[model samples]
Target chain A: MFGEYSLSELASIFAMQGFSGLILFSVFVLMALGLAIIYGQMGVINMAHGEFMILGAYVTYLVSRAFGELPHALFNVYFPVAMVAAFLVAGALGAFVEWALIRRLYRRPLDTLLATWGLSLILQQLYRTIFGAREVGVTMPEWMMGSLKLSDTIEVPINGILVMGIAVAISIAVGVMMHRSSWGRQVRAVVQNRTMAGAVGIDTERTDRLTFAVGCGIAGVAGSAFTMIGSTGPSSGQLYIVDTFLVVVFGGAASLLGTIASAFTISQAQSILEFFLSGSMAKVLTLLTVVGILMLRPQGLFALKLRK
Target chain B: MLKIANLRSGYGASEVLHGLDLELAPGEIVAVMGRNGMGKSTLMKTLMGIIPAMGGEMSVAQTPLNGLKSHKRVAAGVAYVPQGRMIFSALTVQENIETGLTVTGRREAPQDLYSMFPVLWEMRGRRGGNLSGGQQQQLAIARALASDPKTLLLDEPTEGIQPSIIKDMARTLKQLRDARGLSILVSEQVLSFALDVADRIVVIDNGRFVHEAQRADVDAAAVERFLSV
Candidate 1:
């Protein structure tokens, strides 16, 4: 494939495709962060996680429409407000679901998987009934429109840059919470030993609920950021669910840095290959490579060093 | 203060503890001596609320502990160290101690805890798993005391430790009681350890206390008869 192109042409192709890969990486990180907490930390497989993301997207869609009717000066700030709303709504729903559904299924991974799969179906139909089946796009402010000219070979969209910024900020925030904060220590303690954590006066049950809620809330933020690059639809979350799981599982659980690393690797491989191969073919090849490696190392790229 | 009357608890369908009654005054050390599977651990776990009380009433200073969650029990000034030393192995020594302060909604391990177990102070930055069994035991006690609990429950504190460390631990227990005025309920198969530390000794068999005596009045041969296999 490289035989037909000049060196400069190949360089530009790589640079442009790499930028697109960064955008995909942002979305993957956002989607997978929540999974890392739920599946990684809590050992609960939240199959409806993608639906939570879509819930955030729908919330953003509504917020954008509402902002459209408001004063023109307010439009520039609507995205932030929508992101916050998405986090709260999704987190609240997650807490409720933990109480209603997931709590009963703890330590039963297969049950949580099946239960959450059913939950995903219910959420999809709920979204379909309320928002209709048709996909909808958010109205972007003029300031978020246009592209940044970075040399002659690259002109990146401003929204893509904004989404990347949001992803980075959230990643940093999560890392800080998991490492530096006292509550984070309790979360880690519970994840390590539930009975011991309770023995030490840490409310293990409440910790589990908050951790689940926070994970779902992160997914909502992911969905909100996702609106910049993709349209909102009831089934759109389903499109990314498999890919998000791939990023998370391949990255390994209980390690935030691992998720981000795997997302970057997978996104870059797919985007660059998609430029040369068909999109589906690119996806197939990337997945094949990951599967082959995973077969040899079932623990993924980073295994947690927890006590046995 | 700690009291239990007609306590019944067990694992699943087989009831291990059958109507056991016990009490401990403030700053007192009570050792429940028994053979393996004699309900010593069950009594401790039930007291801490780790296992449900099938039929019983337990109180710490007259505050009932039944139906309260384990964390709440800890918040109400009860701390537990289970058999095999159930330390949070992945956490640093300091973090493990800090976990005890969780009920108080505080994060810092008290300075006195460092002085109480200076080995733990030296190993504060190391993971609990990295410590020797004796050090981990000390860390476990530190974690328990970090909450400044009114009562402590320890299961097999001498299990899987060298005899020298066990002696040191007995000394530690006595010092802890005199310093903090804490009530301690320890289950042990090691009679010597019990004789060294406990103010009172009870021989438990089949989930009930069969023989009881003050530390000063305890007949070693009689207690040994109940403990022998």
Candidate 2:
């Protein structure tokens, strides 16, 4: 079934495979972006990041179900609704976590990590209780379920392409928000020097809460988009959390560009390896590579300057 | 104008500022000179509402500042340029300056931070972490100026800075006070700098105000004795 015919056929196969790689990169990049903001900037390990993403996925699932009875034409309009719902659900949860738990743990980063991990477990169980333990496949709209054939030898699924495009757009939007805007500058200021930022009247407290919320909201968007291609369940986020963290840590914290670059490298490597090796072994290989590189460069691919 | 009466503050268990009474007139360069850990910076922080004051009356204009949050005090037209020139290291010079814009609310930054410190203008794209100490000091002071604050609180502005930059900063403070009628409350460890610029001097020793004098009344021997031990 895997065998191909000729040179043109092989080229098409590579193109199709490259498209799949891009899709993988997009998924991981979005997942890592939130983790990057939380862990990189605030130094909060936020092990609950995956759960936040799962909350978004669950929100997407609920929206899709609610809209299922609507006319076919109306289903298309509900996409925006689903996105907004996912963002609000995840962001609200994030704000709550910051207020109830994170605010108290600012002085103890490690404790925050442990506490967030516990929160992640609690959230997962909460999800399982509400959504049931079964793995649920997201039903794509008719337009999303089809594939486009570039040639006789190659076909690329439309849903994967859509995911790839959305991921790139989100990354660009996030970068602009972090680099170009006044609020973005304030966020960076808080990250760089919290006390100094306060001294200058930057409202560091507000910045902290908003930054965490934005991070979780983006994670929700990632999770919602993931429903297009993957299984959704309480534990669905756990499957990606390790990979997400690997991408962020291997990329470097607070470095969005680093996240994108590392996502490309890691996803492509894993995709190529899975083609030759077993799927589980491919992941192990990628993880090992990340570990080795991190050992050599303790600061990862980018080093945020801490002092002059 | 800035005013304080019966200001009392301290860290947990130990009091650092005891019933501190002081005031800064609009457009006046007043200095609080002391040795290390003499509650100079603490007084500055208390005025800015960073560290909670145990008890006191503090005000910027008619707005009471003792109960206000640090950021609110900033918005009330009080600016603080802290010691060690704490500019955001990872931010580019322009981005660091932009932080001042956030605190200023709807008000736009005046013409050019670049004009105030031409070197910062020349290296606007460079990371603040890469700038020299003198440049960072300039950036810190320039950042405060960006808000067009009515009162500027500078804590040890000359610490770890080059002599040329020190003179430039002193000159800039005078010029700003003269031009904008900016109220200045500067904390300093060096007597010479304070003597050169201050209209009045207040001395704090071991967390208590020990002496108050106008420039001519400031006895050098008394200052040295208060600062020594």
Candidate 3:
């Protein structure tokens, strides 16, 4: 591999690969943040989380198609409107799921895993029946198109920069919400001790429902962003589910900073390695490394020191 | 004020509190004394709606609370400090107290809560997990008081606490009762602590209130007989 390329060529390749890795990092962070909230804070193994993401993608697809027929000026602002719609639709469904299914399985983590896995399949089939089996793509606004030239040999995509900005904004928003908001205090309380949270007048059940909804809403926004890089299909969300879960677990549950850090590490490793090796091999090696590290530490990169 | 009539509750199929009746007047502290596994904590849990009341009626300040959920019961002016403190260990002391304010829709805790447990104020930025057991207990109490509840239910507040701190806790409970007109229902294994703070004592055995009397009129020997293994 070293002999195949000259020094200048290698530098440009590495630079381009690094920038691509950042784009991948943005998607991983967006997906993992939602999973972290559900699995880490609420302790609910939501296997249907990917399906929730797909729902958002489908919503975005619908919004974009609807805007295509309207005035040309409407197309520019449709992305934000689609994002909000995706969040609301996905969040409403999440709240319903919590009320109907997740609430009954609070004490049974494994049961929730199985039930949500079944729910994921059901949702996939529902999408297939409604949206068809074909993958759909959204038209990018004019501002989101084109690339910026960095050097004589290296250039960066505007869409990639946009996604990175979204990821950073969302991560900071989540951190502030978790630390500074009153609702976040109630969520932390319930996560630590449900019975005591209830005793102290915190509506533990409501807190749980809202947390789950917000987590799903974030996943919706992630899916909306995904349209810029990948096409939406009934099973597109499934492709990213395992990697996102790995990001969250390898980061350390309940640690927002850890999630972003882990996403960056994993995405960059995979992106760079894929340039030299096959995609599957790169993924396997990255995952194996994470597993090896997790086995030694078991608490991931940053564990919250909470009393049993 | 709090009132319970023939309250029955338990874990799973096994009943722990069998038609137990109790009452508390405004500003009065009632101590439920019993040995382990004798339904002392169960009574407190049931009162707070932690465990469903299998059968019976409960009211706080004339508001019926029989069918209310735990949070709704808390909103009905009842607050509980469960056994082992059960503070949100990962949260900072200030955030832990803010849970109370959040539930009650209040912007901040009362200034008196900080004066009552000054240690909490000193370590406000520290995580609850980092606190000593006594400090955690104080945090638990302060968290409960932040809700400004009409009634407080405390389970084994003095357990594992230092003697000096226990005295201070007793004094704080007395002061809260006298100053705020808050009714308190506390369950304890320590006889002296209960006697030190309670206006009335109820002795429980085998999930029933077998003996009840005013603190001044109670026979110490008879109460000890119910508590002794």
Candidate 4:
């Protein structure tokens, strides 16, 4: 595949594609982090998880548009404010959904999948009615626009680096919160044994609601970061849903480290393969490989051995 | 500290607890002995609000507990160590204990719980799943105590536990009753273990208390009559 290209050209192509893979990995990690928390902890298959991300993207777009009429100085800080807004708005809606719908369907996982898929269709249509069917793009802050020249042929986009950094920071924060915090202990307890957790005084229902909201909130943040890389539309989130689910399931559902590792592997393989083959073919091959591996080892890369 | 009157509950259409009445005073240990499929667990779960009462009046420390949720029941001073221990197996011993504290709005487990269950302290870093059955039972009890509950509900604590630790468990219950003045309602299949630890014994059959006796008056043959199939 590389015979037609010079040695330096091949090196540069590999470097650029690797960087692209990192960006893809960042998006996958962000999306899968939320899915893993919701599906992994609470056993809810949220098909509308993609809609939640799109909601975040829409929130970011609205925040940028609102800031357009304000002072130029405020434009530089709008992104951070938008990220927070995205998280809060998406999280609040998530809590509402949990209370109104997910709570009733918890004992029925397949029903939740169907219901949330229906919810996704509704949300997508709602977005179209509200924000219009046209694709929207956010104007990036000046600081996020340029690329850094690592060598003569190798240049890394500043926005890609920022997204990767955000993914790393958020992953660590979530890891610490889930493992070290007192609330995390309660969440784990509820996950392990709901009746016992309640018997010991933990508010199991409230924990479920909060966990679902946090997962959606993180998805919102991912959507906000996504605008730096791609355009936002009513169904833009659906584009990544399949890939994100692949990342999460290809990892052990409940393992955070596994999510990151699987995301990296999937993204890198797709990116490198895309360089030699068409994009769709690369994706098909990568997914086929994952499906084959999963067939052999159904538990994925990291399975937690829990008592029945 | 705990009372249930005319309580009725069951799984769906089949009722398990049929108009049961029970009471526990402060610093008292009441052992509920029953055969398999009787209402021993049902009564405990009903009191803890894990199983909703079909018809009943329940209270802890004079507060109405009828409509309260399970956590609210715990907040109203009830804690449960369910059958099978039900510890968070993937969590470390410390984390499992910490859950009790977090639920009750406490920042940490009581300092003395560690000394009381020395094995839990020794294996604080180990996962709950890795502990022996006896150790897991101890951990469950320790977790219940972490909430500083006024009433403790234990269902079959010694079912799979070793004999040596059963003695320790009895001693611990006696100490909790005598020293801390904690009210306890325990369900047990073993007559000897119950006799050793209980201040009062109640025999349940077909979801109703068929016999009751003070600790000194408990007849082994009478209790056995209720326990046998």
Candidate 5:
């Protein structure tokens, strides 16, 4: 594949592919970060994770339409406002789902998977009924419409930069929140030993609820970012859900740094391979490599070491 | 002060602690001693609200803890150090101690806990999993103390500790009582350790207290016989 291209052309291909891979990395990190917390810490298999992301996308779309009618000066600010609204709306729904559906299934991991799968179906159909069956694209604020030309062959979309920025910011925020915040302490404690965490006065139930909500809230933010690259369809989250889980599992589910590393590796590998091979072939090769690595190191890249 | 009345708790359908009543005066150390499956741990768990009361009442500093969840019971002033010292393996010693402080919504860990368990202070930055068994036990006690709890419940404090450390643990329990004016309820299997630390001793057999006596009046031969089977 490289034989036909000149050295400069190859350089441009690598740079451009790497940049696109970064945008893909942002989406994977945002989605997988939440799944890492939820599936990793709580052991709750949230099959409806994609639906939660889609909810955020639809919410962002609606917010954009609403902001479109506002004064011309306010239009530029709609994206940030929509992002916040997406977080709260999705978080509120997540909180409700946790209390009503998930709290009962804490001990039943398999049941959570089945129940949440049902929840995803319901959420998808609801989105279809409400937002219509067709996919909707949010109108980009004018500032996000342009591309930065690094070279004649290497052009990067402004929105891609914005998406990557959001990913980095949220990742840092999550890292700090999980390490420094009191709730993070509680969450970690609860994950290690729920009964002991309770004895120490950390409300395990409340911790579980908040952890799940925060996970969903992150997916919502990812949804806000998702609008820039993909249209908001009822089933759009389905396209990314498998990749998100792959990132989480391949990274070592409980390790934040591992998740980031895996997301980057997978995204970069897929994009670069896609440039050389068919898109499906790229996905297959990427997955095969991950599976091969997992077979060798089943615990993942940076699994937490605990004595049995 | 800590009080448990007609306490009955069990796993699922099988009752473990059957109508057991106990009380601890402020600054008192009481040991509930029994062999395995005699409900000593059950009594301790029931007191800590880790096990739901089948039928009974528990209170710490006069706050009724019957319907309260385990965490709420801690906030109401009862703390627990379970068997094997259930430390948050991933958390630093300081963070583990701070877990108790969260009950009172206090962000800072108590400085005195470091003094009480000086080893924990020395290894405050180390993860809980790195501590020695004795160090982890002391850390567990220190963690429970961070909330400034009125009462502490310990289940099998000597479970995995060496004989030398067991003596030190007893001494520390006495020190904790003298310093904090906190009542302690410790469940144990070893009579010598109980005799060494407890002001009062009660033997549980078949989910009920079969023998009760002040530490001075405890019959070593009789208690040993009950434990033999």
Candidate 6:
């Protein structure tokens, strides 16, 4: 196969594949950011994060179905409306989970991990029971369906770029909220030191609920965006959870820079490996690499300097 | 400015503060001197609403504070600089200070607070965890001051700190008490520090306020009987 291709042809093939890797990396970052907030910031391992994404995807699916029943002129403008609805639906469910369960498990990291895992199972079952076990395909509008060509043979999917843009935008917005807003301060206070935060009059419970919800809501948005690249189903979140967790843990908990760096590194590694090895082998190699890194940097790439 | 009457509180099944009665008049520095596990910290927690008051009435600035959450108490003008100075290890000194502003909804940090602790202002960008124990304690006190509470609670402020920093903290507290007329309720194991700074002293052992006296009246013998083995 290599003998038939010139150097320029190989370079172009790698470049095109790398562009696709960047898009996948963007999605992985979005999915992990939410997990980072809930699990890394609050130490609440939200195993149900993927389910929250699925919820968002399903909301987008419903919106699309509703738009399909409308006139062609009306359907075009309804895209923004569907996006908003999907975000709200996911956020609301995230808030509900926080209020009902997350609030009760403060300072219980292992328990939270187990509890959220159970929540993920329940959510998957709920989705399957309601929407059936078959994958649900969300139809995109005519304008969002094709690819954009940059050169003689350089083509990029428009949906991939849109998803990547949304991811970057969401990441920036969440970063600002964490560092700049009053809510962010409270969340940081809670994450840094709960007892002190409480003494200073921060409603740690309320902050925990809001933070967890925000994290889940963002995951939902990622799921909604992902419908363009992958199938949407009750179990859609399961496909992303491993990659999402890998990115979050690899980056280091509670650090946005870590998440971004990890996503970029993992995406490029997986994409490049996919070119040379089988998909399963590429994934295995990525996992082994992450595990090795963790073994060395137990505090992660960016450690939260906790006083003994 | 702050009053607690028959306030009862506990951790799980063990009652730490039982029917405690305490008061801090505006502009006054009141210290609670007791040994470890004597409910001094618990009384402070109950007043700040960190621990739920099990029974009896509690009031801050004459308003009922029972059933109100900790943050509500903060909004109602109560701030606590807890024992061990629980500063956010990952956050910078400036960010740690900003945590106090969350309760105020202010668009900017109060510049007056920086003037009070110039050291914190100098090291504003330094991580809280990187600071020395003395610096962290200063950051904790400064954070409470940022909230600009009517009543300030300091639990073991001078504990595990250098003597020079302790003197600095005492002076700062005196200035804050005089300039702002901020009522203070400090819990301390160091009786000498309390004797020098406090206007009145309250003594507790096990789970109750066993004695209350003016600072001038609290003799070394009396404090020794309460705090020492």
Q: Highest DockQ among the candidates is held by which one?
A: 5
lDDT of 5 by residue, A1-308 (tens): 89999999999999999999999999999999989999988999899999999998999999999989999889899999989998998899999999999999999999999999999999999999998999999999899988999999999999999999999999999999999999988999999999999999988989999999999999999999999989988888889999999999999978999999999999999999999999999999999999999999998898867555
Name the TM-score of candidate 6.
0.93
Question: Candidate 1 at residue A158, lDDT?
Answer: 95
lDDT of 4 at B148: 87
Q: A1-308 in candidate 6: lDDT tens per residue?
A: 46767888788778888988998898898899989998888888888999998988888888888988999877766556766777788888888888888778876878888998999999999999999999998778878879988887688999888888988999999999998788988888888778778767687888887888888888888888888788888887998898988888889887988999999999989997898789999999999988999999976787666556
Candidate 6, number of clashes: 0
Instruction: Rank by DockQ, highest first.
Output: 5, 4, 3, 2, 1, 6
| Candidate achieving higher lDDT, 1 or 2 | 1
Which pairs clash in the backbone of model 1? none
Q: Candidate 4, after superposition: displacement of residue A19 in Å?
A: 0.9
> What docking tier does model 2 reach?
medium
Candidate 2, residues A1-308, lDDT tens digits: the string is: 25644667656756776778888898998899888988888888888898888888888888888888888787876666887898888998898889889989998988998999999999999998998999776667788888998777778899898888878888998899988877788888888788888878888888889889999999999988888889888887888888888888888887888899999999988886777579999889988989999999877898776564
Q: For model 6, what is the error of residue B34's alpha carbon versus the real structure, in angstroms, after optimal superposition?
A: 2.0
lDDT of 2 by residue, B73-131 (tens): 88888888898878888898877777887765644456556787889888889999899
Cα error, candidate 5, residue B200 (Å): 0.9
Off by over 4 Å in 3: A306-308
Q: Could you tell me which 10 consecutive residues in candidate 6 chain B have the lowest summed lDDT?
A: B100-109
Which regions of candidate 5 fall more than 4 Å away from where they truly are? none
**Model 1 Cα lDDT, one tens digit per residue, B172-217:** 8999899989999999999889999999999899988899999999
Compared with the true structure, what per-residue lDDT tens digits does model 1 show for residues A42-113?
999888999999999999999999999999999989999999999999999999999999999998999999
Evaluate all candidate structures by whole-model CA lDDT and list the values in order: 0.91, 0.85, 0.91, 0.92, 0.91, 0.86
Candidate 6: regions farther than 4 A off:
A1-5, A304-308
lDDT of 3 by residue, B141-190 (tens): 99988888999999999989999999999999999999999999999988
**Candidate 6 lDDT over residue span B70-186, tens digit each:** 888888888898888888877889988888876787756688888988888999998888999999998998888877799999999998999988888888899999999999999
Candidate 3 chain A lowest-lDDT run of ten: A299-308
Candidates 1 onward: DockQ, in order:
0.69, 0.70, 0.73, 0.74, 0.80, 0.62
Considering summed lDDT, which 10 consecutive residues are worst modelled in model 5 chain A? A299-308
In model 4, the runs with Cα more than 4 Å from the true position are A306-308
